[model samples]
Target: MWLILNIVVVFWMLIGVLCLQVPPSEFWPAGFVAFSLPVPLVLNFLFLIYWALRRSWLLVLPFAGLILGWTYYARLFAINLGQEIPKEAKTLQVLSFNTHIFNAYDGKQRTASGVSEEMVDWIATHPADVFCLQEFYNNRNTGGYNTAKRIGVRHNKEMYFSIGEFGRKYGDIGIAIFSKHPIIDKGAIHFTKKESINRGVWADIVLEGDTIRIYAVHLQSMSIRAADIENTYSAIGNEESFKKESRNLARRLKRGFIARAVQVEQLLEHVRKSPYPVIVCGDFNDIPFSYTYNQLAAELQNSFVQAGNGIGSTYNGILPFLRIDNQFHSEGLKAYNYETHYEMGLSDHFPISATYVLEPKPEEER
Candidate 1:
């Protein structure tokens, strides 16, 4: 049985290596596969390390390769922060925010009236060239206010929103985009709405004397019921799921995963058709190790991995170690600086922003 487990372990590691092929593309058709990818990654790591110490070096080849390969990629992947650009960026400073329906937090205060003040101040102070928000709300008829319009008015940017599952009239249920540059066009790509909502927004902005397509998105949030949350952790607070319920929980989670996979594929299809280079930034709600990030990031460069330090976990309210929020750019753009704003007491996800210089398109590469 022990021997069989090790063999299973090697095969599992092989799967992880295979998954490296799926880059972060808009066509992320692999659903919960994104959510569950870390399982094999973790398992393989432990087994290989244990085997390495026991003179079982030959059997550890697959995972050993995976570990070494990622290390190499990481070193190669480091963003060049100090490279000189030809000129000041006609570059747009885009921002992605989930806003947690404005129900997110810092640490002490619940995201309500008290938190709103600080957030509004933040918006007023650091107005992004373009802002994409998720879980936003607006209800004009019901004595409601359009968060998008209000924020835009505050920051002097154009705003567009799509209603997803909950609100109406670009009110409360969809993703939103706000741009300092003229918004040439914008809209959303919706996914399975049976359980959770999934969608991404696209905007065409006139920048650097050209139109660039920008995608601001929030993929399906990992569905966690009260029970799932409780069972997925131990008293020690490490991410140790209850063994007894692992199978059933995994099945339920897989459904959510499938839904997200479909969403990713739709996003990819939309992006592929655009006539210009693209930039994608969002609160993906999945970790860096997950399939969702990999799929969407396949064609683009991950700003976090490129320019960020430590793990940039956007979702700080819960499992804060998982780096889910990111800024991704077209292959033609190179990020020079990136930061996950962990200081603000606003939304649950950290605000990730990057300064990038456009790498001139070479004739052959173009």
Candidate 2:
């Protein structure tokens, strides 16, 4: 009994430590759940120990833990939770993704992976009204068959592409927006990027007898390297050496923090200037709490949080745990269906898709 009690307490301590790594943004619903899912299990173990120790009153520890957990995230939950239910209207679905720099992924390395085919198949299964793709590539011509054109042709939908860094030796990154709706006016925003990032794409799409603007972007990556992430592991081999390595990581994160802030600000300016209600989706490449996600998700609400039942992480290929891919929309649009295409098996980033119903335009302002 004494041993069991000690073990359960140790479990709580470990779980508490795990909660510290997630960004402050998900600290609400998604972050809270990530931080709290182990509580119930830990408490169950404690309950059994209490039974043996004859300390029935000790159950209060578990109860208190629950309260603490909720209290920690209550404000974030409240601020984000919807109060006025969105009215129903014809729903239009969209999918967006950044295909990464290689134009190929799916564990295949540099080999020519069938990413285009797989993407088309995935879209056929999901059936989005609009589709957006980033990190685009052309075939043998260095500008041959684009992934967007193929997908659009497969569905017989109009493909709208606003190119960025095109006709360069290796800087062909661009945004592709495809829609069943008639694409009216299309434009692209060129974001300041030292990393050669593709700029944001905007298209006025006609849907369900109404037109709404959709902007898809692949913001400046945090410029974090795989070595930096791997170095985060405990300094197993050489404590002093690992400490020095980790310090370098901290410095890199700081630089990245500043760059990401500037990029998010630029992106937000574009979002705020949209002439019509908008749906914004992309691989933000930053965590929920950082200035990138905070600035981008300011007024625009997250679709995965609004409608997705579980933690809807879109960067599926790299690590199944992080939720960097996101969808945000204006108040008039309600994300009815939200999903992460976790099984596409191509691209380091997973695709995020959502179906939204547009409410009647608000009478107050433009």
- lDDT by candidate, in order shown: 0.63, 0.64
Give the C-alpha lDDT of model 1.
0.63
Q: How does each model score on TM-score?
A: 0.75, 0.70
lDDT of 2 at 250: 62
- Specify the poorest-scoring 10-residue window by lDDT in model 2: 71-80
- Output the TM-score of candidate 2: 0.70
Stretches of model 1 off by over 4 angstroms after superposition: 1-11, 19-68, 71-86, 104-115, 139-146, 165-171, 192-197, 225-227, 232-248, 361-366
Clashing pairs in 2: none
List model 1 lDDT by residue over 1-366, tens digit each: 645776665565455545544543433433334344556555556666666677675545646546644632342224445554457555666666666666523346432333254564565457467777777654443332445545777678887877775534323456777778888887777665453336778889887667878888878766655566566554234434355456566666565555555676777888888888788878776666555656676767787677766555667665546666778887667775577677864676767777666555676346
lDDT of 2 at 332: 74
In candidate 1, where is summed lDDT lowest over 10 consecutive residues? 71-80
Candidate 2 residue 263 Cα shift, in angstroms, is 1.8
lDDT of 2 by residue, 242-336 (tens): 88877786666555555555656677788788878899887777655445665565678878767765556566443455677788898778876
